[model samples]
Every structure is written in C-alpha cells, then in structure tokens.
Target: MSPCTFDGALPRALEQIRGAFAGIDFAEVRFIRDMNGRVHLVLPDSADQAEVVAARPHLADALGAYSPGSETGLVRLSDTFFGAALMDEPFLVQDINGTLIRLIERRVVGQDWALAPGTEAGASVAHPPRVSFFSLKGGVGRSTALFLWGRELAAQGKRVLLLDLDLEAPGLGAQLLPDDARPEFGVVDWLAEDLVGSPMAEAMLVERMLVARSPLADSGYLYVAPATGKRTAQHPAGFIAKLARAYLDNDRGGGEDFAVRVRRLLGTLERDLEPDLVLIDSRAGLHETAAAAILHLDADVLLFATDQPTVWEGYRYLLAQLAQMAHIHPAGDDDWRLRLKMVYARASEKQGALEGFRSRAYELWLDGLYDEQPAGGAEDAFSFAETDDAAPHYPLQILNDPRFEQFNPLEHLSTVGAAAIASSFGPFMAALDERVLGNEDLKAVDHAD
Candidate 1:
C-alpha cells in the first residue's frame, strides 16, 4: 500500500472504512482532523464492535504511518471524550469523491478567522467603538490612514487610542513615540506575560506602561500601544523571544484563545484611558493574528486596496473564506458583513480607474458577502446594487499623493500640513466619522485640487 498524505488521507480512509462496513449505518460517525492535520475516526455507540475490531487492519493501512499504533486511527464515540465534548464543535459536510462526510476540524491557528462574530449588531458594551485598518498587501497606506484618522479625531477634542496589532512588523511605536518617551512595556509584553499568569501584565496595563502619549496630538489624546516598547529598544534581541510567546493560548483563565485575550486587553486599555474611540492597525496580509482584529473584535473593519490585480486576488481568497461562514452559520443580525467596508487607497483621479475598481469590488462582494436577492422574496434582503453609494463594496476614496510616499509623521509634519492631509484623506475621514461617531452632517474637510 502507498503512504497517505494530508490531502489524500481523509478520502482514502473514508473509502476503506465504507468498503469494510458496506451495509452498516454511519449516521453518527464523525471524522476528526486534529491540529496537525492527522485524521481519526470515531464510531457511534450503535456501531458493531466486532466489525470495528475486524476492520482495524484496513483502517491502519488507510491511515498509513499516522496510525502507528492500534488505538491511533479509530475509536468508539461512547468510549472517548469526543462524543459529549465535541457535540457542538463546528464541522463541514465534505464530499470525498461522492461520499459525504461530516469533518470536524481543530486547528491551533485561524480558528477565529473562519468564523463570524456571534453577537448581534450594536450589542457590544458601552466601551469605545473599535475601527481596524487592514490590507492584504503592505504599503497600501493602511497605517498612514490610521495615523491620520487618529490625529484628526484628536484634533477635534476626542481621545483616540491607536493600537499596533501588526506585531510582526512593529512600526507604530517608532512612528509616533520618540525614543525618550517610549513606554516601559508594550502589547507583546502584556500578552506574553499574561499567558504565564504574571503580575507584570496587570502592572503594565494599569500603570500606563503598555501605552504612550504621542506628541503629534496636542489638543486631545493619541494614545499608542506599540508591539514593542522601551524594553525592546533596550534589548532588541529578546523582542523575537517575547513575540514567539505572545500568540500562545492563555492558560490562566478558562483557556481563552488569542482573540479573547486581545479583546480583554482592549477592554483594559479602554477602561484605563477612556478613549473616545480606538483605531487598530492590523497586521497586513492574512496572518493568523489578523483574525482577532478583523473578525473577533467588535470593530468596524476597513479593508484597503490599491486597484492592483494582486490586491483583488488576495481579497478574493479572504472574502471567499468569509463566505463559508456566512453561508454555513450566518449571524442573526446580518450586520457583520456591513462592518467590513472597502477603502480605495492611493486612488487615481481618472474616473475610469475609479469605476473599474468599484466594479471589480462590487462583483467580489456579490459573489462572496452579499445576500442573494431572490425575486418575490424578502425586500429587506441585504443585497445592494453596483452603484449603491451605501453599499460595503463602494469604496471610500483616498487620492494618490506623492507627499505621503515615505511619510514619517514626526519628521515630515510639513509634508502633510492640514491642507495636504485634508486633500488626501478628507472623504475617507468624513465617512469614518459618520460610521464611528454618527456624524451624518460631516463632509470632506477639504477638496483635492
């Protein structure tokens, strides 16, 4: 027999098992795919024990080296923990050639990414509303938009907290915080220490060591939580060590996942700082941690794109993955999809470019996120026309500006003066204010020439 790989393991096992028990009932059987992508089968209580025993060799052969021992490939549901404990675990009805199999998958990463938020629309607590800036490709000006929006809100006398959830690339700290003004610890330290039940996490959270005030804001506040902090600056070598431990599961409290821990941390920061709003700079691309900011946090997620073929293709994959969650177990509110809006970053002035981008985006949303509007069905279906300005696919435009090419807010403050910033980000910020602050009367702060 040939050795089985991950892609072929499930189908081969299903064929072998079905062949071995041709007439047996399999209504309660489940195929479990563990974190490491190994396949195991659990038989229902009604299964024939003698048949299961006799088919062990076939199962072993189907699973190949994965079933090194007699007990590894198969188990009785009644005799194992999977029966009761995994009754509510999410699963997909996968087709192996022609046979349908209920596959329960458990993965250490991307679990939150594939699932939609379970809460109703606007049901979150009274804490400040979160807005995450995300992009599939880097340097699309996602972080710059976050900074500009935070500054704009702060200028309007609103306390804004900017979180750099881009742990791997760690740039927001140096962008805003000067060397002497850096905080003692930052988000990575808080997360890593919290996983091990360290008091330092609480200390850092409570004492403002995890956040710093940016001099860029003089009126209100632009609080920042960088991925790295003063300790990282002092000992650069240990930064990666802390980062490696940051994404681990939290063992201290009910075995919380990484997303839950991030939400808790955000709650702590909101309570401590009492910001008017929170702007999170999410990690660009589909990194595992990006799920926390994009899906789990009760945040309005802004997806950035630059009208490139690669950009649309990347979004196609991301949205198609989300489509699975919507079709499988849609939240009762149907508002989660609305929480995602498109941003045409570095948009061109030519109308052709704008129209082409919008058309492509609308097609993607229609295929992946929008509800199907059947004739004579619900008039309130969550579908929108291609030209609907209110649709999630209709992007808010940010004009291309050469001044922001290599923007450093601290060093190039003159390059992005009020007029320049308003010209580039006016429409985007206006829409953002309406979404976050409910200011419908607001318009673009300045018009681009």
Candidate 2:
C-alpha cells in the first residue's frame, strides 16, 4: 500500500487515501449506492495487480446523480471487512433487499471484469418472462412443459425467472430447484426481510435468496417465487387460504397497485440483468391467484389441453370465464386479452381420438346444442372424431409423446431417442412480448379518422 500518482478529479480528501494506496497495480474499482441515493467507494481488489484502469465515466455520471454518502446517511449496508462506507467518498453500500454495491474511489484503468467492460451500460435489473403453461384438465404436462421452456430459454443465454403460483399443490420448487439449492429467501421472506432482516446488499439479495443456479446451463440463475414459503409450521387446513393471500394480499409486500409493482420489478430486472424472458407457471382453475395474475399480467398465455372430453370442456369454460372478465373491464388500447396464446398439449397422434373430438364438437356447435350439452360430451373426444376426423377449429397441436405418462414435471429434456413434438412456440414469445408492453409507446398513425 504505497502512494501512487493521482490524475482523476476525485475530491481533495480522497486524494490522500489514493496517494497511500498508489501501489495497487491490480486495483478494481466498483460503486455502491443505496435506496436513499448515497455513493461510496468499494476499495481495490487485493488479488489483481493494479495499473491505472480507466473508470466507467458515463456509468459513473449516471450513478453520481445521487448524493454522496455520509455517516448520518439515509440508509445503507455496513460491511465488516470493508469497514464503514465513505459518504460520497466512494465506499460500498447495500439496499433494503440486501444488494451490495462497491463504489470505486474513482474509475481506474487496465483491469479485467466479470462481465464485458464497456457492456455494463443499461445492464441493470432482469424482467422474468411471464409464461403460462397451463391446461384445462390434468395429464397435459403444463408444469413439465414450463420446466422445459425455462431450461430451453436459459440454454439460449437467457435468464429465466420461474414462479410456481400453483398454491394448493406446490411441487415445482421440489422438482427443478432442489432442497439443497433453494434460496434461503422466498416470496414469504419478502415480509420477513422487510421487517426483522438485515441482508447484505450485494450477496444476500442480488445474488442469493430462493434463487437457484441452472444446472442445465453454465451458472444460469433461476429465481422462483414459490406459492408457499415452505414453512415447517404444522398447519393442515389453512394451506389454500394462506397461499391465496401469499399471492394477492398487500400484506405480503404487494403494493396497492399489484400490477405496477410487478411492472417496476420487471423493469428493474430488465435494466439490471436484461433477461430474455420471465416465465410464470400457474395453477389450474379460474378463481385462484394463478388465473388472476396471468389473466391480468401475461404478455402471452399458452393454455395447454389434452385430447380428452373433460379437458376440452374445462378449456371452454376457462375461455368463457376469461371472456366474461374481459367484457367487464372493456379492452382499452392496452388491453391484455390480445396477448393470449393457446397451445393444446398432450395431443394424441394418429388423428384418431382428436378427430372424433373435433367432429363431435363442431356438430354440437353447428346444431346450437353446444350450450346445452355437458362440456365433457365424449370419453376421449379424439377417438369418435378421428380415424378420419376433420381439422381442428382453433389453436391446437398434438404433443403425442409417452413422456407425458404421469405427474413427472421434468420430462424428455435429456431423452436421447424419443419422438418429441417439434414446435416453434419458443419464437412465439417474441411476438407476444412485442404485443404486451412493459410501457406503451403510442405514436399516432398519420391519417384521417
């Protein structure tokens, strides 16, 4: 730790510290600012050989808009190893969520970083893909498809934020993100972290929590907001009720404008991490949080359905319910119904069962008896309709694979020789993202009405 030549315009007081540590040939500069807007220095990386590494001046400029840190600052983290944060003098600080930021004394030159050096601009938060892999009835593998979708998206250099809002039967957390790897923090902890918690700014939040590492890809991070907090408390009957509140109530750290909070969180994610998509795997049925959140939040909704009569009946019911709600709200220019995307899962091949289902439904619709007939008119709709059944009327595709045998949430991801359905539904997401907006940018089309 020897004094080195100073050149950058750091304040006069910091110049003395710079002079003392001039021997840091391997210096790495980082910045930390808290919710109250205080700036602090992160000191040098003791491991690297210091040279006058250049600072991120533009990023620095954006960061400097906040006031300098002070001993009596609004709020920030205290790192035992890094000592007390230096107010505006460029010390480290943490946020309420426990994210750590290391503000450099000044931007230095000639050092390598974890991410691309100049690419740090606009590299802020992550917006998890809001994906819904749902089915009208059981056996369609909606959750399983979601697992694959998340894995596939992550494989393409994308950060996937997956949520299991299927409260009554919460299982995805146990499936993909192992008990060994689940984050210490979860949706339930948001309240606890808000109250009796003091988390490390950088490590505890921005880096850890209910979040898990993607074993499918190299260090791909997966953050899941589980339906239940996985509390070991012995409550038997109150599960569903508590789960319902865990999702919709403001007490669980949800704001009055639940939609806006989700938007801001997504915006923060997109800015901070730049994730490709945020996928949500919701529960079945129309009255739960799974339906409410997606019906209100989805940029795209892919409703999965099997080739069974009962399933189709449920599918129709879901659509009707959604349509009913839409009528109540009335579609504005920002209407969400337009973002709906449907996918018929577990479709049987050979066109046998499917054909029978379609022909029967079509005749039922044409006869004006669809309303009167029980939704589940046939045993396996595909049977009576197919063998030579007509084409499907709406959005439907055959996922006729045996991998969907039972309740296996993870299937066919690594199957060497299986007849998996080939689908281009992945690209379907981009179009939907373009449609459902984080913010609407309405430019007038020049013309007369």
Candidate 3:
C-alpha cells in the first residue's frame, strides 16, 4: 500500500483487530508500524494464537494489504518475529484509536544541560545564541518578555527567529502574526510531516512554515515558527491530530529521538534563515516537551520565576534532577551555570522583598547547581555569592509594572511605546545585553533596584 493508505490503514486495522478479538483474553495488544509503513500485531504468549491467525484475513483487508505474504504485510506473532521487530523498534504503536503507548524511556540526544563537577560546556560560539524563556509556573509574562526582547534585538539590527514550542497552549502565532501574514504551515506541521516521512522538501518546509512578523520588518527580520498552522488548503483541523503524534517516540528504531528531531528542526531554521539570534518560547514546568528546549538545544536558558514558595519548590526539584543528570553525564565544560540566567518577573521594588527573593534563589542554586567544595583547602576556579556581580545566581529583576499586568503584545507595544517598555524592563534587558549577549557598551537606564 502507498504511504497514504498505510497512514489511514493502521488505526482502522487496530480498531478492527480489537473488535475481532474482543472475547480473547490477552494481556495487551500492541500495533506497531515500521519505517516502511508495514504493520505488526504483538500480544503476550497467553493470547490464543489460533484465534489471531483466524483473524488474519480481516486484518489484511482492514490494513489494505495483500493477504499475509512476503510483501509489506502483517506478520504473525512469533518469538523470532517479535525479537526482529523489537530490534527495529517500530516507529509508532497504538491501541484501538491511535493512542500512542510509550514503551521506552525517552532518551535526550545532543548537548547535555547538567551543571555538576567536571561538567564542561559543549556549545559552539559560531552559531547564533538560542535563548529559551522558561518559567516553572505560568502567567509570569515569560512570552511577553520574549516578544519585547526580540523587538529590542531586531531594533538593534539583529535578525531574530522566534520559535514557539509551547505546543499545548500556543499563543505566539496569534500574538505575532497578523491575519494576512500568517503562514499556511507551522513548526508543528513541519515536525509532524518530518515524523511521518512526508515527501516535502526542506526548502519548501521553510518557505511554507516560517512567518515573518511586521514589528521587525524595518531594521531586522523576525521569523516565527508558531505551534499551529494557519487554516489553508493543505493544513486543516486534522493537523491538530499530527501535533499529538509528533511528541511520541515513534522513530526510535531509526535512532532519532524527539529531542534530536527538535534540535534538527532548530538547526534547519538556523541554516535556512541565518538569524543572528533565536528566541524560543518554551512550555512551562517540567515536561518531556520542555526537555528539548531546556537541555538538548544549545541555548542560554532564561529561567523565569516568581516569589511564590511553590515556584521555588518546583525549581528545586527541577534543579536537583539536572544536578543528578550532570553527575551521571557531564558536559564538556563547566559553563552550564554561565549559560543559565535567572529572571525575576513581577518583582517588587521594596528592598526587603527583592533581597528576600534573591536570597531564596541563591539558596536553590547553591543546593542544586553549585559544585561541592573540597574537604581540604583548595583554590576554587569559580565561587559565587548572592551579591556578586559575576555570579550566575544574580537575578535580573523586572519590576512589577501595571502596564504589563495584562500583556497583549501589539496593544502593549503600540500604547506603551518601545521607549517606555525599555524603561520599564531597562535593568533586566541591560544585564541580558551585557552579561548574556556580550554587549557591554549598550547604554541602559538604571531600572535595577
């Protein structure tokens, strides 16, 4: 069968098989689809093999394949067959209705993000810096900050590519793209098409998906890879279904994990667009989807956090996990801490509140990221105090501005003006430009407390 036929056949076949074997007592029924679109049904040895064999004719018919023969067709459950299929690690598996059943631990490929003893930095300076704006808890103006930052960079004549990886709650597209400028496809569309091995060319993928926003049209370009595609002839509501499938480990057998694919996608954008900087709007909290942006992608991570106890508690858990991962698999350099910067959003101007928030942040970093001191007196290569200027734990504070309380990018930009936005977020942006972007001479207002 053709790829299209295979695409529609697998789920239908599984549903039919489930109905056909409704009376059979089986531990679990798994439907596996190989790279070449061939299908296989796996069940525990407890299942009645004779009954399964009897249902072969119906399965073949449902799958639109020739009767079980040497061609690309269903294979009977056997020890040898199972072993061979296991080696290939079929691209995807589903039950009666295309619900992916994850069978393997998702492995992250590429640069590691662990900050521990002996861990070294692996990021290359040649590529443009990819900065991820992340928050443990939502509603902290993470994406809003990203939009303003991108605008500032573009205003400085830097080409920017803004990627929205918040798949479940995508908003960057609507915020950035005007109705007429919205692209037919999006990042998710390209990802889904790539996962399914579509015949679309890479160049076509960039052309169809990357939407250029108006705000950065004058000085520099702002290209966006939104989460969902625009309504078009090619991309319809069915594309949403592809979004659900894109996050699965369906292509593990081919040695391409989801993280690796995400990296490749970003790389492709970099190659095609040649943007000076890439800003990624990552998913909030700790999730497999967030892992690609946080850990695998070689990005300077901007970890946004509030003064809430629960927020810091979440950071503690996340940092502890990273510290442990670092111990197991260290990076090439110890610059993991350097690549990370803390952003305190919705911050208070009161000295005590600011100091209290910074103190709590310092404690979390010390507990989860800083290297352990030697028992004897040994000169440490790097040491940080909460008040140290060069420390990574220093918080870039964005004081609470009622103007940004209800953020709508276009409305805020038009009403507030870039000058006021810059004034409001001055210190944070200045620190970012100096510390993170290596622009030491940029004159910024003293909005820092």
Top-TM-score structure, candidate number: 1
Per-residue lDDT value at 120 in model 3: 28
What is candidate 3's lDDT per residue for 1-449, written digit by digit as tens? 44327447656665665686675433244455443455656655555767666777666766655223323243444543445355333222223343443121123432222222122223333567789998987789898888877777776767788999987778788787776677767777666777767766264454655555655345566778887656532556676687776776445445465666777777777777777789999989887677677776778888998899899899998776665444333233445556777888988878698788878888888887776566763454334778975666778888888888768775556787666677668778777777657943333322211
> If both were scored by lDDT, which would come out higher, candidate 1 or candidate 3?
1
Candidate 1 TM-score, C-alpha based? 0.85
Predictions ranked by TM-score, top down?
1, 3, 2
lDDT values of the candidates? 0.81, 0.43, 0.66
Clashing pairs in 3: 91-250, 119-333, 120-331, 120-332, 120-333, 120-334, 121-333
Each candidate's TM vs. the true structure? 0.85, 0.49, 0.68
Q: Show the lowest summed lDDT stretch of 10 residues, model 2.
A: 109-118
| Candidate 1 wrongly placed segments (more than 4 Å) | 1-29, 42-76, 92-103, 119-125, 327-334, 371-382, 440-449
- How does model 3 fare in lDDT? 0.66
Candidate scoring better on TM-score of 2 and 3: 3
Candidate 2 residue spans exceeding 4 A from truth: 1-129, 188-207, 218-223, 228-244, 251-273, 325-335, 352-393, 396-398, 407-449
How well is each residue in 1-449 modelled by candidate 2, as lDDT tens digits? 22211212133223333443464331243444343434444444352222222222322342343424232211222332444434323232212123223333232211111111112222223334465656555456677666665665455445667766565566666666555556554443442233332453223346545455545443454455554333423343655454444444244243322233334434543455445566766667654444434554434667665556676576565544343233222233334443454455655556465555455445433332122334768532222222221222233454555644564433434562222423423333333334333443322222221
